[model samples]
Target: MLGVVRTLTALDRLLDVLPVLADDMRVETRFAVAEGSAFARNLADELHRCQAQVVTWDEATGKDFDLAISPSSNGPLHELEVPVVTLPHGAGHHKLRATETGVAQEVSGLSRDQLMHEGRVVPAVVGLSHPDQLAELRRNCPEAVPRAALIGDPCFARLQVSLPMREQYRESLGTGRRTLVLLASTWGRDSLFGRRGDLARELVATLPADYQVALVLHPNIWNKYDGLQIDSWTRSARRGGLILVPRLRKWQAALIAADVVVSDHGSLALYAAALGKPLLLGAFGHDEVVPGSPMELLGERARRLQPGDLRAQIDAARPVPGHRQLAELTFQDRPYQRLRTLIYQRLELPEPPWPAHPEPVDPFTP
Candidate 1:
């Protein structure tokens, strides 16, 4: 099996399922970093940490394989001869990104132009997390609908599996009894950080001693601008008791540990809501989100963060009533297992002997 990585987010999502295949002696997994995303930084380092056998994109495209899997569709997937599976790298692909020409926008992952080339579909199966996405794809890219598969979401599955470990996660973060407020942001000129970069500092300064504040930035932000730049941007906030969670690792645990999450239209918000955490949309970029996506529904129903008594807002925040609807949209209970089956089918191999149950993610560490 070959894993195609385009961004840290893609890599993060890919890592969730690769272990299922890698554990089987019958399968061999190699990683190829597709060169395109500005957020591709630190991918090599992450692959190194996993001790993954790395191959160049040139090599990946030149050679044929049993199957290729990627959580992103950004690369030249059409060039590959092998059966490719395109997976969602986030919460059900609800954002709209500009086309290559910067002239018009399409739903990020469902574009026919992105999924096909020369009047042929690229991926053998386009993996989606929900049935709603299947409908959305039909509306946006009808030609690709025949290839769509509902693979569920391994990341959200892992998050759910990690819920029982919440206290351990909190202890790791040193939040013994304090109310934890997690501020999450996606990367863009319209994200929470873009709208109010100093919100973390302001929360830290305004909230009482019984409260703990942490920031969870999207990997794109960290990579596009680098960590040194981020530290410099949040230096004062760091000094003011705001915990800047590392981009790659701690955000998951922090989300599990948080009492309330303040975020934008990022996947984290959707995940937090689905997990039944009190959520507030700190800044939502309406223009960038899909018109009728679950995220858009969330933005409509969830409370909007406002400038005021931060503590009161935190205290009064409640999980959105629409959270169950979001959860329903996510589909199955076990995603990795489903993914393993799909992969084996794609590779024309028998199922592995061992179970493919999701393991709890490691505890958060600073």
Candidate 2:
């Protein structure tokens, strides 16, 4: 209902972008739909494309099920009984009250009073990355932290499957002998660098001859603010010998191939951390979109350097000695199996086997 702001905050939910889990669980969808809204229209189109059964809540009554899911802080949270579950639309360390989707007043954004009510009421919650996450949940929105086992993030679990080989990705994206640096922008205007698409130019101008930068943009960045400038920069950079990664599938592939990832508190930093590569913090912790995701802590994990020090930092960044595992802490994997198991456990239905492989992903397509 907050339109673009909400759309940018939780596009995956807006598009109904779900992962292909093991079983064909019938997904009956309901929308607090705002007619004529561009985001609403996009959501309807995406849900149709996903072939989900769209139904109003009234139409969905009496369906035999173990649980109903909101996939966000809101979604008919009230008017339900025990065992109704929520899968927060976004992840990390922010309070539900702080998100664009968490109004706590409207059905889209549940009011604080209602949230605490639900917190004491709902049986379970899904998609928490770490055990410590719950402390904040209970501390900040005690009324909303559900009373059940916190399931690991299904999205992160699915993302944990092995990625495409670096060599294969290198050949496809043509990084050749140079080290690959992915210059990512979550919100170019508000990132620590405080400029739109200009960091790529700065990096390109200063990086050593052996390194090549790849430009990958968040959908919000290229879509809402800097499309023309991004395109122009990408083209000019490509001519000057940088690689311009394709959107969606190719972008995911580029993530796998990146030797170092640079971002200003974007999800890419989190994803790159999941990939177990060295990360370069740009925005530090400037949270223009949503403050305090688990990702905002990446500045602690990565090397913080000025724009001029990027190349040198990359050179100096080696694994942090022994026993210091990186990135594995980011995602709790097994999301496909977890959801199916939860359905079986809660609904007394049979669980499906895990997918046999790590299927290809398109970061922008959904």
Candidate 3:
């Protein structure tokens, strides 16, 4: 199997599926980090940690594979000669990106241009996490609909299994008897960092000793600007007791540890809501969000972060009333089993005798 990883986020999502094929002695999975994405950093090192064999993009293209799988649709996905499976790297597809002309915008991955290359569909199987997305695919890229497969999200499956480990995660983060406030931000100008870069610093400085503050930023921020830039940007926050979650991992542990979560329209926010945590929309980029999407609905149901005493707001926060609805929309039952079935069918192999299960996520690394 060929794993075409484009960015850190993509790598994170791909990790959820790779374990299913890991234990099979008959299979070998080689990873290749597709070039051109600014957020593609430490990929080789991360892959090495997994003990996965790393191949150059050139070599990946030169060799033949039984099947190729990628968590992202971006980059050179069409170059692979074998059957390719493409999946959403986040909580479904809820964001929009500008067209090449910069005049019009469309759903990021569902657009025909993104799903096709040279007048042909790119992925042999386009994985969809929800049933609603299939309708969206029909509306956006009708030609790709026949190829679309309703594969449940592997990341959410892992998170669900990790729910019982929340206390262990909190202990690892050293939140001893204190309320942990997790701030999550996506990338780009409209994200929390872009809107309020000093929010973490101010929260750490202002929140009493009974509360601990931690910031989890999208990997794009760290790789696009480099760690030194982020350190410079959040030096005071770090000094004032801010915990910046590691870029490559442990963000999920932070979510599991959080007593309350402040976020924009990122997938972390959606995941937090699904976990039934008290959620506050610190900053939401409405223009970039898809209308009537699950995220847009989250924006409407979630409490807005009002100005003035942040402590008072935190104290008064309640779990989003729509959280159960969000959870229902975000995941499907028995995802790992479904994923294993999908992959084996694509590989033309018989099903394994043992039941498929998602490994519990690792605890907080910091």
Candidate 4:
């Protein structure tokens, strides 16, 4: 059994590669959650669909797994004795070291300088978030070049909606016909938007009058900003000829349906880019901002949203042909194939043919 320890965003990518492995191999997978939080429950629910077992740290000791797969940094799981593969969740600097603990692990997705600085002290594997990321990683961790595996952003491989749901989602959310989907989440303290209230108002004021705006709030924001009157906000936007739909829907469905998406630095923009939807990324607080990210790999398909520039950006937003093509080329390449092979090989299983028409798992149902 492969033990996966990570967040839902990380699991989103794992699910994409795991099924291909599970279908052809003899391995039974399970999740080892750190705590029984909402994120854990969501992860457990998704894993259950694959018929994988789910366990918590309190229930099962960390030593039980044959191999531990962490889609995020495994630095937190250093105490475990199992051989671990760490797939960093994002593109940035990472410090890899033994850290006063005895755990042999490799950290993927770091610049070359970062790897050079830390590789001397710890076992590390470097993978790029973009072509540049790989270049930087090699420059920093020269030794890691041989062992480095190009496992792309796991988030790129999330399950999308089925054809039926796609149509239903379109009808329910007004996806087609010059529509803009606003993916809202709670901005961190250091975010440029400062407060959720300020961002919401800015969105209301800035969006074009002719466009239909669907505000899909993240689950976390639903609880935190419950006091804000969504109906009133929608009414104000409606007066400007913008249709504001406040009811939430699955992120995948929204991404697929949207003509363009305006979101802060979150997984939604990534999903949009994967689907070839035009994306305008909003820069949040200080820490959330990365001047250039894998998102830029989308080229004209995406742009960083600037203050007082929303109208012009929205006007220029158009679905680019190479959006999904580049994404597949860069992140969904052979390294992902290797990860799939590793999962199957570990399970001692044969490979399954790729499903021509895999049904999208319903987010509401699971």
Please give the distance, in angstroms, between residue 108's alpha carbon in candidate 1 and its true position after superposition.
1.2
Q: What is the descending lDDT order?
A: 3, 1, 2, 4
Candidate 2 minimal-lDDT segment of 10 residues: 1-10
How do all models score by TM-score? Answer: 0.96, 0.70, 0.96, 0.63
lDDT of 3 by residue, 184-272 (tens): 99987788888988899989989999999999999888878878899998999898888989887689889888999999989999888
Q: Candidate 4 — what's its lDDT?
A: 0.49
Estimate every model's Cα lDDT from 0 to 1. Answer: 0.85, 0.51, 0.87, 0.49
How well does candidate 4 match the true structure, expressed as C-alpha RMSD?
Answer: 7.1
* Residue 251 displacement in candidate 2 (angstroms): 3.7
Off by over 4 Å in 2: 1-20, 23-70, 74-84, 88-91, 94-126, 192-196, 208-210, 226-235, 238-250, 286-297, 319-330, 346-348, 353-366
TM-score of 2: 0.70
Instruction: Please state the error at residue 246 of candidate 2 in Å.
Output: 5.4
Instruction: List, residue by residue over 1-366, the lDDT tens digit for candidate 1.
Output: 789998888878887877677567877888888887767877878888878899877778866578999888777888777889999888888888555444236778888777888898888999998877888788778999999988898888889989999999999999999999999999787899999898998998888889999999998888888889999999988887888998675688999999999999899999999999999888998888888888888989999888877788888899988788778875556788888889888888999788988777887666
| Candidate 4: count of backbone clashes, pairs at least 3 residues apart or interchain | 10
lDDT over C-alpha atoms for residue 302 of model 3: 92
Q: Candidate 4: misplaced stretches above 4 Å? A: 22-25, 35-52, 58-63, 88-132, 139-146, 153-168, 172-178, 184-212, 216-249, 284-293, 296-316, 319-330, 334-336, 352-366
- When sorted by TM-score, best at the front, the candidate numbers are 3, 1, 2, 4
Candidate 2 lDDT over residue span 198-271, tens digit each: 66766777787878788876654544544467567566666666766543234666777778877666666666
Q: Would you list the clashing residue pairs of candidate 4? A: 13-154, 25-349, 112-136, 112-137, 112-140, 113-140, 190-285, 191-285, 192-284, 192-285
lDDT of 2 at 4: 14
